[model samples]
Target chain A: MFTQFFYTLKAYKVPVSLTEWLAMLQAMEKGFAGNNLLSFYYLARSLLVKSENFYDQYDLAFREFFTGLEVPEELFDELLKWLSEETLKRHRDSVDLSSLPQHDWETLKKMFEDKLKEQKERHNGGANWIGTGGTSPYGHSGVHPGGIRVGGESNNLSAVKIATARKFRQYRKDVTLDVRQMKVAMKKLRHLRRSGNLLELDIDESIDQTCRNAGEIELVYHPERKNDVKMLLLMDAGGSMLPYAQMVNRLFSAANSVNHFKKFRYYYFHNCIYDHLNAGMEYGERVSTAQLLKNLNSSYKVVIVGDASMAPYELFMENGIIDYYDRNETAGIVWLERIANHFRNVVWLNPNPPRYWQHPTVSAIANLFPMYQLSLEGLESAMVELTRKAH
Target chain B: MQNFEQYCGTGDYIASRALQNDVNVAIALGRPLLIKGEPGTGKTLLASSISEGLETDLLVWTIKSTTKAQDGLYIYDTVQRLNDARFGDHDISDIKHYIKHGKLGQAFTSPKRVVLLIDEIDKADIEFPNDLLTELDEMKFYIPETAETVSARHRPVIIITSNAEKELPDAFLRRCVFHYIQFPDAAFMNDIVKVHFPNLEEKIMKEAVEAFFSLRELDNLRKKPSTSELIDWIKVLVASGTRPKDIGRELPFLGALLKNEQDYHQVANGETDTRSIRRPSFLR
Candidate 1:
């Protein structure tokens, strides 16, 4: 009776040995797990499986093997929520909706207005009303040819627009990096143009020089090739960037770990690159834009990490900054333009997905400096672009 | 095991029906209960609570990012053994003297079944969970130094907690009984507060919970006050002899609630300077 269960676990790569199977069988004989299916499920898993990560996989296998066993509603609810968002997003991208009749800008606007007035109470899985699931022309977690998302999380990219006030966590600065991988990728940013003092021996060059000197064995010391790349990383550490904290931290640590730079300095900004830059949270020295322009020369490769998602007013309108006293002389764009003029190469690493680059605030920043995703691949390409002229 | 009923029944730790059910399922299966939740959601407390309830000795293993799987097993002090063999007055060739059992090892070796708390499993590297796969499943591990196998006399009731800082691998997740502790709702939170502050006035408790929920609803604020923060904030409120209605005037003391500088500025500045705060009516 338990053979099929034992085989099922093994098939799922659970690494259940014969001895363990026998032990479980003996335990079954002793009536430890009892007759309860849920109890049996736990007993089998505890006896055969280890590690919490595998619990999810074992659950799926158990559900399938048992067939019609009632799982706790909470688990299903969480799984469905996670899957709907992810699966909907993935399928939405691949699923071609171009063939469907496209609604013009005016029609979309009118339809959204109509749905807002009609949507009185909460609705789900229907043809209309802002709710989750179904072929509604509005809401999220549902399939539709094209619609708008309101009050729910985004998954179905078919939505013409989204209006959400989701809060994100602050980008942590303490995330450690895989130094080896970071070193390999960061080597691309090396500007080996100049030679410095002979600090370390170059075995290959030394050997060649000795052979050229007719095996005289006298050492020939040459100036060491240095990584002359200078980088100025200005990170947006507040508000919108809160969600991408982990990814941003990885990028920050990656940049910090790489030793292939002549000068590497970093600063913290809120949303947009404004006149004042914060050095630290407490007793943070507010460096003026003029001081920054004067101190860092054009050789510095400026890389910025931010979601760049903020109200347009914060970027364009005067005195529109969210935090601190908004006594800036000009708009944020003006300060950004000045920084761009001073720096030869700049790349903005947005922690938010590339699909969100179309957001007005993000697009506005993208127009100023070349923007890239904050993934390892994204960082690699950005480095390549930064080193295009130098290499 | 019979005492588990009474232990859970009278325990200080308020077990939601869902939580209790999950624990029961884990016990039935003899599997480790993998409890993942946000920080301050009582992931650590559950272990001690269960141990207290079960009348079992609780063995805790707090894991760090650098913590290896081998650290949970018996650690062989080969260097010490070598030194002892070379320089000691007596022949100390027995490897048992050099072998120190870790929390997991000690739990497995205990005469009575123990409650093992593996706190912050996600803090360790990816390989740590996978390394424990065989040992945890079989309830046994080999000591190469002693050339002997150490098997559990009684299977421990293990409670593993993760903050979900890093994603656990699929294989590692499949083996355990999983439970996710959600942030307690308003009514549930009231009960949770009463657990900590029993003698506090009902009106003050109600007002404090209301204020906490309102602060949580502020989407702009970073690091909103969690359950622990709310309790701490209420503790200060009751201790200072400040009435619930007078909380509006005591807005200056918001350090307990808001941790972020930006959040502090948003709440504080919004209260004092209305011109600077471009917020909704409720926030103003």
Candidate 2:
């Protein structure tokens, strides 16, 4: 069994040596690994793998070698069935809110609460279930008047608040997003300051000083160039944002690499800025909008990234924050206004096409803030607007 | 037969049984143990501990973003050779004279088996690991300029660490044993604290530990306190002769725990009780 596994790793180009194989066999003779699959996995990796780079390969080989012993195929089939049913149920639960008469915030809230009380089992394609694709004032993906989206993609941003446990891939700062167009766009935020430790040789200073000192040929030193602009980026993560992941990731990576920002701080939110802004999904750090506003000075430039396509109520509904049902007297629009007021230079970067700018929710947001398409031209114009002096 | 717990003398370092087993397997297979963890989880210390336990010399090769794979194997000094040839220097004809054995070459040529630690493999370029694949697999590398292949005299116990700053190529990750060092829980943290502060009063230690965990558990903190940071905070508290209950009162020392401005303001402004903050409607 060990030999076959060893052969498997070798086939994967794990670079296990004959002597190393002998050593592993010797360790096994001493009863190193018991019947535990995890223990065996650890044992195999330690002996056969030499570099951290091959760990993923070792994992694949180990899983391949130990197939049928771990996860059962029947279990997978059951899981798939459960997932499909859940999806179908969610789809069916979505009520056509457009067909129903539009209700005021209070009435809709009251109806939503009553529906929540009566909802014993998951309902779909119904008038009342707080599930997706239905007009029920509480779930996502279906047209609903004054509805709160529970879990699913947002088409009409109708939800006062969104709630889901879905995880999002973190925007990797280390990955170089070196698209030439993005780089060109990033130049707008460039505010370089040469300060700190001496990094680059000051050629002009050196020559001037040398000439002044009777050609002593002494070299002068200047500090490294640093970006002095303070950029505060609030991004939309998850749901409809999933389709625009690559574009957002590119933007994120480019923004980080620009290295011209004296201070670059990023916080993630969904759809609109609400009461609390999440530091990151993985980090799970929740910062209150009040706290964030207080922390950042008015000098900081704020960039809001989102499609801005949601129900108009989402912007105006009290306690209508979509991710969670937090009942605040002030709505999301109030929070947006407060943030805009606090920051002297604020711009909204919409990844959604300009054709979608006519979206009720999107247009409403564009009116309140300077909205720019997330493109080379849009970024350039946004930066020009931001850099424009009081005159 | 000794485990990592034993290897990390005086400090337990939260060495899980799985990690110990993987190290043992690495020893048995003559393969490198690749450890991935968040920053400040004692990834680098593991290599030193293993070397100390085995009583072997440790050869460390710290990787930078600019570091090339050629930096690990060997460097052929063509310029130096050319200069020597022009100056009619002796041994200009000998290619060996121009060759400076790099970290890997030195480890391979060592008479005794050494512990080779390749720290922060993710810092290097995407091609860095792939470039070393042939040498790592075969335990030998050929110098194109020298037209000579140099092989390992003794198989060194290799340990590679990554913070996962960059995604390593699938081909490179497949060649090694992988272990993710998880964040220590409150109980596991107690053991680590005891190792660091043996004479700390139980009351003070418990309070400090509770406070540490509370701070770490806080969902509002961007940078969570790691094991080492917790240890440092405790050390400061002990040095000041502060009682366990007073740990929270010393607001000046709060910098040790909460590193960020927002975090400091949040805690200092009496927002430590996160439960008061509303959760999502469904979650509530």
Candidate 3:
């Protein structure tokens, strides 16, 4: 019955699995959700959605499946309150349903449909119909203990108003990455090697030696593995990159906070890397591009963050540096090419969306280095690219 | 089949209806409840609440960055065995003597049902959750050294909390029931505060909660004051003999709330208009 709901969740890219759907069905079959739509909503959500990151998508899917059902917020809240109270009372008193009139599943479903139609036609005054606060066997706040409470009220909106709220929209991964998420992405760039002094005991080797020595104990120690990856971050600062300053700052801080790297260095450039890069934003210690290329070996993974948007001449022509005071002997593209050639792994993170990459400068820079969007998924892929072996 | 007890909110821990429903569903289904939330939203406290409410034993396993999944199952004390062999003081031949059961193993071996809380599972390596999938699903772990399978006498109610530090693998997540503990709204926060400080005057509680929410609403604050923080702040306010009317105005003992220096300064410097604190449209 819920297969279509499963498909709807998939359509919304919620990543719900058949296993989860079956689990929710099993819970429902066991009467875990009882006859409450609110309880059912929580049950399905808890069972089917694995991560809060996909919660907004799940909410959308749920709303789509239960569209045209908007229960008044106050009424829904009251129903939830009443249902919880009823469940608590049931638990306390061990409510027995054998005394109540019972009907088979098909009869109950048909009765529920007929009562719903009657309630819609009558509007108000139906004490024995599928409406609230009545002895009708089909709706909540009624005295029928054994009857199935219809999931939603007709004429009124459905219980999906909760789903339509979309409270988890902030958690969507497609949104801009937060500093903590950025740090998590940066944490994946690990190239561990046993470079430190021997400290950790090699248990297998020690056990082997003990056995060979006939009951004598032997200890073996080896150097602990350490992260040997060195990262060189070159970011575009000022001018066109102004809009993405906060995002770029988050990336910079995330990288700076991750202390696992063997060596970490950052420099800023206005439009592109020119004769030298600023050690800080616009004004700071100037490290000549030649010096950076000479000092940092080819083994260093380089990440360049920028919008990659600029006048075509600024990238292609000599002395086309954005800062008029700074005269560059070589074109911006040539400097980028030098860095790309020098580094074994290099990736450019464009703050602009992939669609904007069609611009002349962005595409030109894309040709020089593998460019990725600055979103969480993009950063993750960029991190993957940074760890990939050079072809 | 054994009857699974439902976990209503305990006197001390005020769980919302949705949270209570999710907890009961997870308990009934016998699946590990994976909880994600902002720090200090009572994720860890829920495990204790469940154990207390169900009248069962509680076992906690705290995860650190260096924690391995194997450490939670059973730690084979091979080094102890080796040391015993050298000293000739203990039974070195029997591998069972060297086997030390971890939190999970203890929970599995317990005579009665227990609540097992894996606190901050995300602090461990990303593969940590995946490594324990089989054990969590089957409720058993086989120790090759001892040649014995330790299966659960009763499937312990497992609650795993994540700070969302790292994204867990899909395979691991698929095996568990998940819930995100939304931060409590003002009304819910009032109940939570009353649970901690029952004797607090209604006026002071109202003003303190209002002040706390206003502080949380301030933009650019590094760390927003959570429920626990609000409780502490109210405690300080009551203890300091602060007046109810002076609660939001002076924000007495602000240190109990805002831990970050910048957040404290932002609230103290009158940079934020506390009086005009806009409540979010959706309270629930």
Error of 2 at A51 (Å): 14
**What is the C-alpha local distance difference test score of candidate 2?**
0.68
What is the lDDT of every predicted structure here?
A: 0.67, 0.68, 0.81
TM-score of chain B of each: 0.91, 0.87, 0.94
lDDT of 3 by residue, A259-350 (tens): 88999999998888888999989586898999889998999999999998888888999999878777899998999999889999999999
Instruction: Output the better candidate (1/3) by DockQ.
Output: 3
Best-to-worst ranking by DockQ: 3, 2, 1
lDDT of 2 by residue, B1-284 (tens): 44422343324444766677777666665666788865777889888888877788999999996698999999877556645664675677778888999999999999998889999997776568888887887789888877988898888888899866555665675566667675776787788788777787998778777777767656546577787777888888888888666664443377787777987877777633333223232122
Give me the displacement of residue A175 in model 1, in angstroms: 22
lDDT of 1 by residue, A1-391 (tens): 5577667766765556676577567555545444334445545655565433344445545644543212234434433442344233223333323233445446865876676666555556555565566555555555443344443444333111210111101211112233333444566677665487766545566557656866544344667556789988888888667777655665666678776678888888888767788886322787887798899889899898888888898889777777665566678888888887788888888877689888898898899988887765677678888876632
> Measured by TM-score, how close is model 2 to the native structure?
0.51
Query: What is the lDDT, from 0 to 100, of the residue B214 in candidate 1?
Result: 72
Which DockQ-derived CAPRI band holds candidate 1?
A: incorrect
The digit string of per-residue lDDT tens for model 2 on A30-99 reads: 5565423345455655665544445555655655553321223453343232223444343322332224
Q: Judge candidate 2 at residue B236 and give its lDDT.
A: 83
Measured with C-alpha atoms, the lDDT of residue A293 in candidate 1 is 86
